[model samples]
Target: MTYKQEQLSEEKVFKDPVHRYVHVRDRVIWDLIATPEFQRLRRIKQLGTTNLTFHGAEHSRFNHSLGVYEIVRRIISVFEDRPHWNKEERLLCLCAALLHDLGHGPFSHSFEKVFKLDHEIFTQKIITGDTEINRVLEKVEKGFSQKVADVIAKTYQDKLVVSLISSQIDADRMDYLIRDAYFTGVSYGHFDMERIMRVMRPMEDQVVIKSTGMHAVEDYIMSRYQMYWQVYFHPVTRSAEVILSKILHRAKDLFEADDFTFKLEPTHFLSFFRGDVRLEEYLKLDESIVYYYFQAWQDEDDVILKDLCERFMNRRLFKYVEFNPNLQMKDWMELYTLFQQADINPEYYLVVDSSSDLPYDFYRPGEEEERLPIHLLMPDRSLKELSRHSDIVEAISGKKRTDHKLYFPKDRIEALTDQSLKKKIITILYGQGEVEDVR
Candidate 1:
């Protein structure tokens, strides 16, 4: 069968918690799902390290990837019956959705920051490089793999198809928001996805929601905002992330130290420590392998590395206090000095984590990260910007909100021999004991 006509004898169905059932009809998609690269997602958590805070967040990328593919499949099926929709791009959209997140490494946020790596770069490589995924794409047709990668990169010529996969409101975000909420057991992520999809129309270069479905769309945006602060940006989740990033930084530094002997060879991290990780080497690294190294490092001679690993493994995350690092530069330095005197190593202990987002935005000229403003297709056959119509989104549109927190291991500081230092630190963290502890 030709790529356009390829199909499984019987459609394959995977019962999903978020999308009900993910049905796969194309042979290429079926084969791609069985590849080693795609299967690797099973070992990587969807929300890395969030499991330490919300224990139910143990879902893997594999689950979310499949959900994305199913969403795109359903969208394509609907688009097929509408005007301006092309049937030729059917398989292309599905494959792109399925493999978009294929190259994410273990604890990607920390690993990417420490190693200066980009999972998107590796994603394109896996699709275009010499891998099982590439081999399967080549079977469908030569050059099919690059087209899929370009869709994920948002550089593809078919803007409608690209928007369906990666635009501001696309299959990827829609799937994760719902899927993550389901696993995290949070109520903020609930929205009318079915109604939103019904109103989603394929425009010349983007997807626009019908005015009749404005409330559903509004709910989706609010859900995204709620999910961001309530679940994705939870302080406890950030606490685990703080320890994770420190562990990676400490390990990289220790690797550079003279005659550093690792009880367990960091076979997966050698190239990363040297700042040159090849695609093949990167594909070998996963959550399991990373955790194994952390377990081994707990027995290492480096106290920081050992302690950080213990903190991560034992769920002993750092406590955080709200602080504007820019305005409190002097306060930050004082804490740094205190940490050093207490032998806590401020470099790893005193961490400032920032989470920022513009709840909504209109297309602005010459901006770095420009998001296409949400457009509502009015009954008069004219388009209106979302913020102009919705007061809720307007109040927050183009207004960037940022939250800063100073993270430190309270237990370590409290263990200091000097009672005065502990009292000062407590005062700095919470003046007059505002709360018993930082959750």
Candidate 2:
């Protein structure tokens, strides 16, 4: 029998913390899940360095990936009964959802930022290249893997299928919001996901929510906004990411230097440092391997690499104060020189991190990340765009909110022998009399 025609004799169910039961009936999905490539996700954290802040956010990408698959499965099951839905695209949606984050490497954001790589590109490679995922997809049908990859790449002909995985309010966002909130033990991501699923309707080109489900959709948007600020963009997590990026940058600089000695060589990172990372070399890295290197770098000859590694692994993270480069350029420059005068490499020790979010947006005619706006199917059979009708969603729609923070090691300044310099730094950070240590 063709792999596409295969099914388990009995459905396999995974007990998930968020979705409860991730039911798998397709033999292809079961086989794909057990493959080494997919299983590697077990070692990658869903929220890298978030565990340091929320102690409970120790969940792996494998956990969130399965939850995404389950959400797609449930959504597709309902879509199967709809008139406009193409039942042939069912498995493809499931595969795309399950593997959308397949190529996320260890500490994804920082690693990608350093390496100048996109996880989406790697995801396409994993699905369409000479790998286990590709082989399983091939057995299903000729070029089946390409179809799945196209869905993830948002280049498929069937816009409805593409919407299932990549649209404004699709399975990927739905699952991650709830899953991250669950792991991080925060209540911000809770929206009526089940009700939203019930209200979803397949359209000629995309999925739309029932007008009656406006409140639920509003809640989902709000949840996303809240989670972005309170959880995903948490200052502490960004501080850790800053250190991680600096460590990679420091290691690469030392590797390129004329006379640099190292106690522990970064075997997996050499290809990356050379700007020629192969897929095999990339796959070999996970958080565990990263931690191993951090432990070794602590004893390295380069003090900067050793310090950044120790800060990342030992929870001695840099602290931050709010700063806007637009209005506080002088403050930043002052702090920059003060840190240098204190014998700290301001480049590694001082960082300005910015995060922005647009809660919901209508489709722009020609924008870069051109997101298709969410449509609500009216009871009278008319279609209306979301923000136009929902006050809560409209208030934040197309309004890009940005946050900026300046990260530095306050501990070093506090420990300075020159109390006057320390006081100057503190005064510059806060105000004349405002001085309190932030860890």
* CA deviation > 4 Å runs, candidate 1: 432-439
Provide the overall lDDT of each model, using Cα atoms, as 2-decimal numbers: 0.87, 0.89
CA deviation > 4 Å runs, candidate 2: 432-439
Question: What's the number of clashes in each of the models?
Answer: 0, 0
lDDT of 1: 0.87
TM-score of each: 0.97, 0.97
> With candidate 2 superimposed using the best TM-score fit, by how many Å does residue 355's alpha carbon deviate from the native?
0.9
Model 1, span 1-439: residue lDDT tens: 5865778889899998888899988888899999999999999899998888788999999999999999888887767767888888889989999999998999877678878888898999999998999999988888999999999888999898888888778899899999999999999998988888888888888888899989987888899999999888888888888899999888888789887878787888999999988888989999999889888889998889999999999888888778886788888888788788888899999998999877778999789877888899999979999999998888778888899888888889878889898877777778522432434
Q: What's model 1's TM-score?
A: 0.97
- Clash total of candidate 1: 0
lDDT of 2 at 22: 95
111, model 2: CA deviation in Å? 1.2
Error of 1 at 166 (Å): 1.3
